[model samples]
Target: MLDAVVVGAGISGIYQLYRLRQAGLSVQLCEAGDGVGGTWFWNRYPGARFDSESYTYGYFFSRELLDEWSWSEEFAGQPETERYLNHVVDRFDLRRDIRLGARVSAAVYDDAAAAWTVTVENGERLRARFLVTAVGPLSEPYVPAIPGLAGFAGVWHHTARWPREPVDLRGKRVAVIGTGSSGVQVIPHIAAEAAELVVFQRTANWCTPINNRPITPERMREIRRTARTIHRTCQETPGGFVHRPLSVSALEVGEEERRERFQRLYDAPGLTMVLANYRDITTDRAANAAVTDFLRGKIRERVKDPEVAERLIPTDHTFGMKRPPLEDGFYEVFAQEHVSLVSLAEEPILRFTPAGIQTAARHYEIDVAVLATGFDAVTGAIRRIDIRGRDGVRLDRHWEAGPRTHLGLQSAGFPNLFFVGGPQSTTGNIPRATEIQVDWVMDCLRHMADHGHRYVETTPAAEEAWLAHVESTVRGTVLEDATSWAFGSNVPGKPRVYQLYAGGIPQYRARCAEAVEAGYTGFVFG
Candidate 1:
């Protein structure tokens, strides 16, 4: 029996395995895929890239590793990112500890032994004192419930699960569905190759320029100088990206300055243009309008057809509520003669025909279809695993309405079972959140080991209190109104509770700290 077993070999899983190994713990990492790089390994579509940019969307644990790797682009594609992760595995010698092509089927807490017996699909059973689920937020792909999605005779693909080999869309009529981040990034590439590309937009999405360019050698060296400081500062930021150098808040800049910078910023691309309004865009309606309108005007200018441009511009939700998209010429691609936008709200998908898709308006024939529908997110991966706690109660049955856990890590009934990015996790608690979380779990494990403890679980009170706090946080912000995967609003039949903590990332850090300082208060340490 190993000391610990980690599920999923993504970025988080890789780091988790390394940390435990460095602590001289007996641990093994299991992945269902053939290799490492969880998301990067599967999503190999044309324009699939990271929104957080190249250098810092990686492990910051080792200075040598940080300094050694060189990024090929400002925002890395799926292939390049995969290579980097594989290199991390090779350089750190993480292969021996990893069991690839092995999917954990079920995990049950055996009260008699006080250990989790994990069963793999191939009938391999392994027991460990701790079972950590490092399954990512976007692990499972979601396909829409359109009447006849499977009936379409030709090729159909989800962006999340795109084919590993090259696809030929040239001279083929293609229909692309969904307008989220991946949809926005991929449409242009699809349009370029297809004879005619019809984009099905259920909701018009807000888009900012990616402004991606090759990271110059000179700039790379300069970043290397302050790499440690930058890495530390990013932990402090909300979304894990390096914030702009402007110290003053957007409100501090003048109106004229704001207008000029907003225009300049809008053109500059990446995330810099997201805040041209020079004020708080989240709560303040006017500030949010300023940013949204600027992007709308940009779309109008680039798209050739006025009707298509109007269809492309989103009017309903707040900017940050849904995951924001970034691209250089996504809007411009619509100007192409072969490209057209189909408003799904205007013309709902009636069904899929043998040769084409039948929207309410008309039937458009296509050779290939791209279902850019996003993942079930946050809850999907954990739900996929069959986890039974002390009473042989399933995690899914307990979470039928919604998911609930203390600190999104430990559940009340599940003793000795752990989750890395679990429910009730304060995701908004920026830079220090993940650092604080991993530390807390490790501390709990170490404490249990030293004291001859068997299994430590959260009290029902702790789970309920933390769950209420998470709900309150989500309802307090614009996030509650966000009808995206973040709130489980996109997928039907799933509970409508908030999956991530909307309170500021820094605030979350303090709460976790307080819990630890109070000797893991509310946790039942046996």
Candidate 2:
């Protein structure tokens, strides 16, 4: 049996495999995709780019790797991001151990042998002492159950599963559904090409400007010089970004000063508008409302039509409640003559007809359709795989109410199984968060090896305590009130539970450190 088997060759999986192999352990990685890069590889839609600064989103473990790769833009596009991941894989020679096109169908734990037998879709099975699921939280694409999709004559594609080949939308009548992050990004590019473009939005989201620009040679040099400092800032901040919120609350500031600060952030690059905003904007009702009003005003100013502008503005939730996408001229796209906005809430979609979508009010004729509907999120990817632990307990059934785990790492009754970037994990700057998780898992594995333990799992009491801590941490935050994918609200019938650990990165790290100090408390190894 191998020492470990890691599923999904994404950022987390790649790093995990590298760390495990470096420790002289027999480790193998399995990727479902034909190629590596996981999220970047599959999400090849137009205008897909980094919201986080390119530097902060990449691996910080190697100074050599950081010095070699130079990003072209402050926020690199999908192509560049995919290439960067491929570069990392090649640089580390990680491909030989990674089996491409090997989708994991089931992982069953053998209590007697103290090993996990992982079955791939291709009838291949691998037994390992430990199993690490690096399958990303957002890996499973979620397409809404709209009737007559199969009967429609026009071609339809989910944004997550966009074809590798370039899609020709030139002069074609197109309909784009859902206005989440991907929708906002791809809609602008589609509008520029399609003869008639219709955007179907169920709920309007808070979007700020990306303001992406090419990185000059001078800036690249400066970035390389301050690479350590940049990574340090990400480590120190709450959201794992270089952007830090102000110390004072928005309620503490004057209206004039607050509006001015909001405007500056509006014009600034990346997610600074939200991540670097007032301290209380995400917590205090009045502070969140003030920032929300400012953003609504900006949206109104950009869109020429008053009705369309009003449709674009979100009314239900606060500004930072849902994860906001950084956009480039997104609101301005509606100003174009050929581009139209269809509010799904006002006129719900009846079904997909032969020509296009038929709503309650009217039918939209289109040649092509694009679904930007998001993912099942945190627990979806792992739950899809048939995972059986002790006593043939099903993972999906165990998490039917919601995910139960200790620090999002391991669940009770699931021996030798670990999760990185899974449910109850950190929220922002995914790569940075996953890096921290991977390091901790490696440490835990080392601990097991040194102690000559073959099986390990979290205690039921520990898992319950961690779940309680997660709930308590997000109890009063704005996130608890919002009905978004962050809380698993987008998927119908899915448990509406807070999916991520709302605690800051520093606190999470400290908690892990405490576990180590207490001899890996709440975990049993035999």
Assess each prediction's global lDDT (C-alpha) against the native.
Answer: 0.80, 0.92
Best by lDDT: 2
lDDT of 1 by residue, 444-508 (tens): 88888888898898888998898898888756455667788887888888888888776555566
lDDT of 2 by residue, 1-526 (tens): 8989999988889899889888888988999999988899889999999999898898988889988999999999999999999999999888889999999999999999999999999999999999999999888999999999999998899999999999999999999999999999999999989999999999999999999999988898999999999998998888899999999999998999999999999889999988899998988888988999999898989999999999999877779898898899899999899999999889999999999999999999999999999999999999999999999999999999999999889999999999998999867888888888899998888888888998889999998999999998787888879999988999999989999988978788888889989998988999
How well does each candidate superpose onto the true structure, as a TM-score? 0.95, 0.99
What C-alpha lDDT, on a 0 to 100 scale, does residue 250 get in candidate 1? 53
Reference-based TM-score, model 1: 0.95
Global Cα lDDT for candidate 1: 0.80
- Off by more than 4 A, model 1: 244-254, 274-279, 426-435
